[model samples]
Target: MHEGATLGRRFTTLRAEPHDVPGVDRWVALDARRDVEVTVDILTSLAPGAVRQAAVRAAQVRDARFARVLASGRENVGSDRVTYVVTERPHGVRASDLIHERVVPPRVAGAIVGEAARALQVAAGQGIHHGFLRARAITVADGGRVVVSGLDAEGELATQAGLGRGRTEQADAAALAHLYLALVTGMESEQVTVPDLPDALSLGAANLARAAIAGTGPDTLAQVAAAMGPPDPAALRGLRGSLPSLPAVAHEEPQEPHAPIAVSPETLAAAEHQTELSIAAAVAAPGVAAEVAAERIVAPELEPGAAVDRSLYASPEEAAQFSRRTRKAVERERDQPLALDTFEEINEEQNAGDDRSVVQATLEFAQRHLPRNAPLDAAVERAQDRAGRSGPLSTGPLLVGLFATALLIVGLVAFNMLVSPVPMDGLSTREPDYPAYTFSPAPLPSASPSATNTE
Candidate 1:
């Protein structure tokens, strides 16, 4: 594996070497976002879609004996579309490696194979079969825990010569039997033919393996492991080595302090004098009140240790320093009466007068400033006169209007009578205002000639 390589664009590889799987490349990668370590199995020259689909199915199967699939996808590397599956990193030596060094007793092998078989059974119940189950697919973790890897992405095992691929319960059972044989015999072979076992091997386990190879074994691999019983604790003691020791952490060295900059004697003395001036000015003068000095000086407070005097206004000496125009403007501003003072005087006068509502006083005050327009005044006076007056002049227009309207209607009637061609007598045949059915009498029965003769 390349240094600093990543899988799924999320999990970054921390180790340069991959785990010892037969065909697939497995790296211990760190999922930085989740802050957890995971195993990323990169399958080369395989169908990315098939492996991804299998990984999805494998993820749904959860068991302590099985490594949990976390994620899977295809990532482009150079000219190749690499298919990778991420799973929880099982912390144990692979059964293939452990057996390669030395074969464990049949009982211990049974325990490990049984756990793997049970895990496969669970997966089978959910319709997911481990297509390629080899000795390397199982791991002997701490406390003799057996964890089985390789689920949907088992197609990578097919890349190894002499290993066949089968995606069914039967295939899984047969492969699991093959793994058990390899574990006990310490022989790493992927063949299905049953080999001669040592006399120490249990007859039940031997028979089960033979039947599994012959396709006549129990329906589930778990049942076959059950017949073999649990493993021996003593036999399993030396199978897994001690956990690796943690590396010593190095402490960071403390940094040296920086030296203070050196200042000359004259610069130090000037800085101290400036600080003293600032302190004195702050203590003696309180903002705007400081301007009341006898003689106005430009930035006088900035002078070191300058004394300030207490006064309400500048002295004649300071006033003389200003221009004539400035003095005139100031004098004019001081002489003018304030709006508040004028309002107080007006209020005092009102208090001395007869008691009056505020609204009435306000109206009187507003009237004094009202425009004295003769036309407007005359218009208002006329409106008041008309309001009070009760005579013919006020109603004369309405009366004249009604009389003129009557005269015009009579003139129109006379003109219409002279111009119209239809006669008044012709109106007799016109329909009445009420219903004709109700107004007209019932028609008299017309006398038939025969009835008249009988009468």
Candidate 2:
């Protein structure tokens, strides 16, 4: 047992032996300061230098949804050699566990796929790929938060071990679709019967899943995420059905505190017997026959090769007629003004007469109020003569000069108010009144000065 063994400088105090991770053996360990838990993968079967390359590639990934890598190194203990890769331990149960237990509802499953798709999209932007995405690699945290582990490092390790088949954006989409199907049907299989999906699930979800599974849907993860839209928490909760609890694993005699316990033959037999008995009981239960019949009636056979033509035109005449109708519809839509635009046009037309009347009234008022006067006419003539002499004053310079004069006056006023202090002498000279008190004087002793002369 290497419970207290430390790996890299940051990760110290291994708390457990290598357990089952998606593509590698994972050991839970405390960080250097023991502040948080981290997982370390010992890639013993991977080709030489695989971990190093994966570490370099993973260092560039900055997506929050990815399980961040802490460090990677090569180490040898006794006759065994392995590469260690440390990553943050996300606190959640494996998505596979939930699927096996039949806890994830259809809507929740869509949401989970959507989240994984978002993470994949982020990784794709950086040219990073998760070639080994599986139910075990995905963790479903509280509040439906999905965390994808085993990014580039797992893929590299798998390739080194000759377990990697192929990796592409299309492959990832298909795998995600398969995952969604498994969650919805609670079945672990490579192929899914689209017709078996519950009618309660939306048709859009079914189409999206079918397209992804067939590799005929959106090519990129971003498009897949967009297609899934946002998951409805209320619908998920309402539609989810209760499932039976998982049977507890039988254990043998206790061993060392952190030592691994191997399942005995007796334990395996007992577990198998229990599972068989449970299945038998479920089969013999009442309504079992009726339920199976209902399922058959609800799930219809979907022919994969069946094609439905959704085109509007089937012949040349039909095509011409459809084109003409489409053209007319478009023209009508284009020519139709919006309600606001129509209202604005009508308002302008109605206000035109009122505007002219107002202007005429203003002129008449100005004429009545500002009657012609001899003195005013003389002043205007003199102003015109001065302007002519000045070679026609520029309005721009005159306005600028007025603005500058106003600014100067404002500056002087501000300076007087802020910088200068007013004298207090002329305000008031009266002193504040207070109550007065008189003290009686005591007689002084006069013998101390004469005492020195007498001595």
Candidate 3:
């Protein structure tokens, strides 16, 4: 079809090129009678009855989120018979274009997919489903509105029929999930392997995507959408204002040639007469231009205020602000003392190498690059071999480190036992001491002494 060609004597094609839908020749056309822009999907290969039925069901789905179907019928144009469905042209950036251009944050990507799901959920309620769903079929419009095009047209034109409602619904949900994944991961929907979700995605969103990929999504499309929650307004704000406007029809009309703008010589002279006179006078006078240039190059006179030392570094206000901040910081430090002088201690130890403990140094170096456990003998041999190869560094230090670790552990155990030891009587086989709670309260009586003696 060529541009300006009329279909059914109503919709006129704005452009000769058709949108890249796999099996359908979809074009952006203007509905002459309605004075509105709409998309016309011309199907010469699909079943006419199926196409009409799909369009009729799609038209029944009245949603702002969807590009509403206007009409569908068989049209005899020229030598061939074709089935066409006219739907409102969606006004926004297609998800396909947006995802390809830049990396969309997960929140924005999820929001786009969530809005599509909500629209499809509504369509599914009326027994109408978008059997063929992909990123290309969805649009992100201004104010975060998602207008889903090719709802049933895509399926009908692509021959996606005979898939039962259950299957179609599941396919749509999975396709939506794939679309979300593509937006988030910047991969195509047809990718066989599911990519890893970005760390920024919330746990709930990750789980929802994983479930859909595993073929255990929610029972209804609505449930799947609800789990994603509402679209994030903040994320959507970034995508709202960049929607592409609908293409306009190019009707060539006779254009009159624009005359060149002209200005009179007298007007030009009047505008710059004084400036011209001054320049000519300056040129006539010898050394006047040079004097003017010298005057321009000369630095301005300085004003006296604060001394160079203080003012060069900072102004009064800035100095005051800094002093106040420093005082506050000192007060805070005084109130809350630091647990350790970490940097100072480390720097001192690093600088004063002679004062450092040999055993401690060996332990630190050994711990810094400790490897997996090996036989003690093998490790000693390797250390010895390395020490021999490198003269000053010896296995003797490493040996001391191993002995120090063992001695430290033993010392700790001995300290603990000395501080809190088990009683000698506990090791005896005597009957275990009765719990204090088990003994009944002493029979309180005035004659307590006699009761005690009896006990």
User: lDDT of each model, Cα atoms only?
Assistant: 0.64, 0.64, 0.66
Which of 1 and 2 is ahead in TM-score?
2
Error of 2 at 330 (Å): 77
List model 2 lDDT by residue over 1-455, tens digit each: 25666665566645555444334666787887657988877665424355556766876888777888888765444454455778888866567666645735566777788889888887888877887678878876654467898887777766755655445676666667777777777665355566766676766677876775565765677666766677443433322132334322233568658778796444444444445445655686566645544433122344898663323113445445555676798899999998768766765555443223344455545544764432333343334333333232248998999999999999999988998788887798789897888666667556797797999
User: What is the number of backbone collisions in each predicted candidate, taken in the order shown?
Assistant: 0, 0, 0
What TM value does model 2 have? Answer: 0.48
Per-candidate TM equals 0.45, 0.48, 0.48
Off by over 4 Å in 2: 13-23, 76-81, 212-218, 231-455
C-alpha RMSD of each candidate structure in angstroms = 37.8, 34.0, 28.2
Winner of 1 and 3 under lDDT? 3
Writing each residue's lDDT as its tens digit, candidate 3 over 264-353 gives 443333334334445655785567766554433222345787333322233445555655676798899887736566655565555543
Which stretch of 10 consecutive residues in model 1 shows the poorest summed lDDT? 242-251
Report the poorest 10 consecutive residues by lDDT, candidate 3. 372-381
Q: Rank the candidates by TM-score, best first.
A: 3, 2, 1
